[model samples]
Target: MLGAVERPQAWPSFLHQVGVIELGKDRIEGSRLLVVASQANRGATFIAQSVTKQGLMRSYVQNGNPPWLFEFFVNESSNL
Candidate 1:
């Protein structure tokens, strides 16, 4: 899980609800510093493990068993 100190100060609550397993500062070839987020439900068993990276926006999400902190899975991988 992203450490409280490392998490964005103004991050959306919904994103937090989705739950994070890890968030790190790594270098992705073309980028200076990339933030990779390992989601709580994005395990090897899940399907549609999707990752999208556009500019400063990078996201990883997967579709699994049930809803998270909301009625529906946040950042549903179905959209991927």
Candidate 2:
């Protein structure tokens, strides 16, 4: 389960519509948001589609090796 602060207002509705029932959560400000993708393009595409579809902020792929092999951060904004 996610902490209440970690659950964004848009998450329940948007994630369910896309079949994302649950995910690990972290603090919204200055914290990393990670998503796993096998290919870089797919990762980019997923981020683009989700941001567009869900009225979320636009984020960029982080440079350098992240904690996870397929990790990227979602820049925090009002949408989150």
Candidate 3:
């Protein structure tokens, strides 16, 4: 989760509602940062988890030196 001080000052409320917030200036080898969060429902959880998986897949496709490996599981109803 991004700290309050790190969050954008003029962020959109709708983005927050959908669970996407804090597009940071930081980067990994020039790739911009994208932070997602959800404080409420299962829809938010799905967005967060889906974005995470897509990001990982993108990284693996772009860079495969050591072969990126990771595992995650999310059950939206329980927000696990």
Candidate 4:
């Protein structure tokens, strides 16, 4: 959802806003996915809903599968 131009910088800020849970090499991939998801979720209400419904599709395409991206829905609703 974030414009392509915004994605690079926006990803980190989005991760911080969503409270990244873990750190290290294992978590790096997940964090990246979460950042992508967060950016998609922030673009607009519809985009947020879409991203949530799709369950990290953008993240998957962008960064491959990350375990935490799957767990994110358990800890936080996409509505936020």
Candidate 5:
């Protein structure tokens, strides 16, 4: 079975705080987001999605607070 690989240096620091969620490399469409392909801790694959830096910033402003995307992604991944 494949395990979560070390995050790329380019990945944002915020990703380190999300515990153990694995993401795919490709973004959906031109949207600034990636698919949360699998959840390591849960040992389950998922179709949920998370946003990229630009998307996160958008969410941060929309949410009006910290934890920019923790809440949004913790539940289920969705298209941008």
Candidate 6:
């Protein structure tokens, strides 16, 4: 569960929120907003995707390659 203040209005905020979720960070904001804005399962999925995309972007910047292709590969591999 997340707090209200922890919920994000933009992409970066969303990403940060997800990081908090992953790291088990506490938030003073209510989780209601996150729940109301996005249903439980959807919100979780959105957070996961956002985090994965951010990870891919960071990796791309570090390696100087297309992140999307690598993202696709990783996603496919994960499914298998």
Give lDDT tens digits, candidate 6, residues 1-80.
34423544445646755676655534544433334433324434554575587654355456654566557556655654
Error of 1 at 18 (Å): 7.6
Candidate with the greatest lDDT versus the true structure: 6
Residue-by-residue lDDT tens digits, candidate 3, 1-80: 34432454544444553244323433335654445545445454644565587654454346642322222223343454
Candidate 6 ranges with C-alpha deviation above 4 Å: 1-65
- Superposition error at 52 for model 1 (Å): 9.2
| Candidate 4: regions farther than 4 A off | 1-59, 62-64, 78-80
Kindly list the per-residue Cα lDDT of model 4 for residues 1-80, writing each as its tens digit. 23322353566656653442323434656444333444445444443575689775486578764676455654455555
TM-score of model 3 (CA atoms): 0.22
- Scanning candidate 6 in windows of ten residues, the lowest lDDT window is 31-40
TM-scores, all models, native as reference: 0.16, 0.24, 0.22, 0.20, 0.16, 0.20
lDDT (Cα, tens digit) per residue for candidate 1, span 1-80 = 23333465545553654243232223234433234444544542233332222321232323334445243345545544
Model 4 compared with the native: what TM-score? 0.20
Ranking by TM-score: 2, 3, 4, 6, 5, 1
Clashing pairs in 3: none
lDDT, candidates in the order shown: 0.39, 0.44, 0.43, 0.49, 0.39, 0.51
Which structure among the candidates has the greatest TM-score?
2
Backbone Cα, N, C clashes tallied per candidate = 1, 0, 0, 0, 2, 6
Model 1: residues with Cα > 4 Å off, grouped in runs: 1-7, 14-80
Model 6's alpha-carbon lDDT is: 0.51
Question: Which segments of model 3 are wrong by more than 4 Å?
Answer: 6-39, 56-80
